[model samples]
Target: MAGAAPILETRDLTIRFGGHVAVDGVSCAFERGTLTAIVGPNGAGKTTYFNLISGQLRASAGAVLLKGAPITRLAAPARARLGLGRAFQLTNLFPNLNVLENVRLAVQARAGTGLDFLSMAARRRDLAARAEACLARVRLAERAHASAAALSHGDQRKLEVAILLALEPDIFMFDEPTAGMSVDEVPVILDLIEAIKREGDKTVLLVEHKMDVVRRLADRVIVLHNGALVADGEPAAVVASPIVQEAYLGIRTAP
Candidate 1:
């Protein structure tokens, strides 16, 4: 799964909250154009690592590098400018707006264009096209005119993907993408993610609890336990590790 130069790297990344170390001196290289899934038991420092990489949480020590360049100092918004995009653990959407409108706003934001220009059709033509393309990519183009609130949970999840697509980021970090979807909705959202992974040559770092989703979409799996890396390698190999079975699957590693 790892190929080309690393798009992001953490050199002994560490963080501490008082006496608790949330993420220890962990070093990792996330390559470009691959999907890497991070999994573990609860409190495995999964989201914590995401915050550290995206600059949402400042590291107590160590650095984050993008394309071999240090970006550990950049704020989340600043990192977005450099092609790092994150879909929050919670859904962020404008319910009143139609599906297209929601993603169009993202497209405009990515261009750094002011909303005041939204009334100018000619000025918005390009943005409108780009937004539509994003919708198409996420398979929501047919519902472009529908109110966002009217969409099903699965569609809303896909809409969020469209919004992320509009950002045109090179690296995408997802925190629990299937969290709130219903059982049926889970497969739909998972399929959408798989489609995106298949269609693009983008780098994706995902934190997912659904073992089924992880098994299908991940090129590799990285396991975290007690705020430190416990496993990292191909999905099958890592998932079969006795340490992972003990920590997450409760299989209990032999004493």
Candidate 2:
């Protein structure tokens, strides 16, 4: 729908550390159930912007709003409780725990169940069933009992995704989701991400370096250069922008 109020928005969202302004007055919104990609060269403050919105980092100045309500004061866990889910650039997995245990624990926490793992482990059979469904969605059900450490790197990434799915958030944020996967593994992870968009209908914010992934999955693209929003438009137009081309995508001169 055109001109719909954003599901999430930042009002002059700014951040700084000493003299370095990491993100400078970035004001943008993600409409309901849209997948928006944040793309730029290293040091463009893409992840920092993500952190600010998701509550992993405090804004030096400005506000983060969810559905026209301010959430800048909310902490990371609080945001998660309010339907915000984040998957990090680095895999967040409990290596000593089995795949099922990892996801089940997230389900327990997301449910606001008490954190007495030792005492609650046996009684949370329902949580296990929920976790199984999450793993199945990510195609990790066959390795349900496999120790996270024993799984291949690609599977570990999938497990992390399963954990996020278990949280059942309304908004999903991903930071460099394919950063360390093998070439063969990239397509599988991308497929899962695409599936998440189609199946869950959740609002998505992604920080990704892969052009192919961004082009394929993003409904819109927001490009950053020097910690500021340089372009915001459809993928084809943004990628074709001379400003984006020169600053980040590299200008091409005809031979």
Candidate 3:
């Protein structure tokens, strides 16, 4: 009788560091099957807001809700267990492990299979199959045996996405998914993200600075400035708003 609750919601979420408020009382709701881009200039708290929601930083005030349930107090791993997945701006990886091993670990974690090296051997075939499938999706299957640390920046980014895929989260949070990638390597990641949006069952939140990428992928856009939400609307409207144009896009109208 009632409509389904939003996949994620932040209610006046605030976080202060020392004397400054980094993310100031921002409230927004994200629905299923929509991609919302969070855009702002450097130091606008976009990533900090993401850290709070993903449980990397504690919120000084307010709450984070997943499917209408409060998860503000949960730690990062706990939140991940609750279906909140985050791919960082930096490539977070097991540098010592080979690419396949890194992804297999995520698969094992998601399947509730503890990381017992000896026991893992018994389940290697199945877990590796699943992990390889994820890698294939991101075009990293050929690098399965290579050390994750040795991959190029672009490949590392792809491996991180593969790991995220292995976890099968309901909400995908990507922080600048294409930060330092090459011109040639950028499209693979973008195509993967586009495919995710096309799935139409997952909720996606992206913090990106590239206006073109935002325009192409975002269903909605919300702007943040000085840790506070400044503008929110359809992508074109939000990007063209005077406040966003001045604060984020660095565009100033002539008098």
Candidate 4:
């Protein structure tokens, strides 16, 4: 088990917009079964880095490898098919569909069944059952019949996670997973992430601004500044480092 290759990796990954280099040449590897939290000041390119890796933004330079194979040219949907799942800062769902249908579609997609919803529903009861299980995991079973547009923002976020679960990817990338949720709604997502970590198979990459959440969930922490990887280590060590204290946490000790 020791020395297995990392499930996901970025090799000097970078991207630029005209004159600005949003994500500089940053490289890192993520081993399976570990949760790495990416933290930085606003505009430090954390989300941009995630976008490059997840194929939302193509890299201007460098390579992205999944299990050591280059996938830098792949599109977002291509990356998703190859086991990269991403949950965005804003909820992405079918506003017109009911809660259950949204997840059922994800299940159907993962099963390689065409999206003939009516036909699939008639032929495959297992898809619906699997979707229900994903919803229950996110505490949304009772709202299964509710329209996605009708649910509150917090519930919508939960439904997004359920959809991601239904896809069953090997790598889970969550960008600000708790950004807009109420305090009461934060724990459900956190608990679900903790459960994923407990599974000890899926690799998770989280981009978060909440220090408390990072402290509680990250197995390791990586700090970025000015579009570069500034620090990488255990949570306590990274958080306590002088660079992070001053730049990220806004703690300035006397020179």
Quick one: ranking by TM-score, best first?
A: 3, 4, 2, 1
**Model 3 Cα lDDT, one tens digit per residue, 1-255:** 149988899999999889999999999999999999999999999999999999999899999999999999999999998888889888899999999999998898888777565664536698899999999999999999999999999999999899988998999999998899899878888899999899999989999989999999999999999999999999999998899989997889665
Q: Score residue 154 of candidate 2 by CA lDDT.
A: 79
Q: List the residue pairs that clash in candidate 4.
A: none
TM-score of each: 0.87, 0.91, 0.96, 0.95
Question: Is 1 or 3 the stronger prediction by TM-score?
Answer: 3
Answer with 2 or 3, whichever has the higher lDDT.
3
Which lDDT tens digits does candidate 2 get at residues 1-255?
Answer: 467578899989999999999999999988877899999999999989989988999999999998788999999988888888888877778889899999998898888875565665757788889999999877889999999999987788888888888998888888887787789868767887787789646888889988888899999999988889989999889888887788777776454
Local distance difference test scores for all models: 0.86, 0.87, 0.92, 0.92
Q: Give me the candidate number with maximum TM-score.
A: 3
Candidate 3: what lDDT?
Answer: 0.92
lDDT of 4 by residue, 1-255 (tens): 358778988999999999999999999999999999999999999989989998999999999999989999999988999999988878889999999999998898899887565563745789999999999999999999999999999999999999999999999999888888999989999999999999999999999999899999999999999899999999999998999998897889789
Decoy 2 TM-score against native: 0.91
Candidate 1: tens digits of C-alpha lDDT, residues 1-255: 345568889989999999999998889998777899999888889999999998899999999999989998889888888888887776678999999999888888789885474477446789999999999877789999999999987788888878888987888888898887778657656776776677667889999987878889999999989889889999989889998899878798777
lDDT of 1: 0.86
Q: Tell me, what's the RMSD of every candidate? A: 2.7, 2.3, 1.7, 1.7
lDDT of 4 at 241: 93
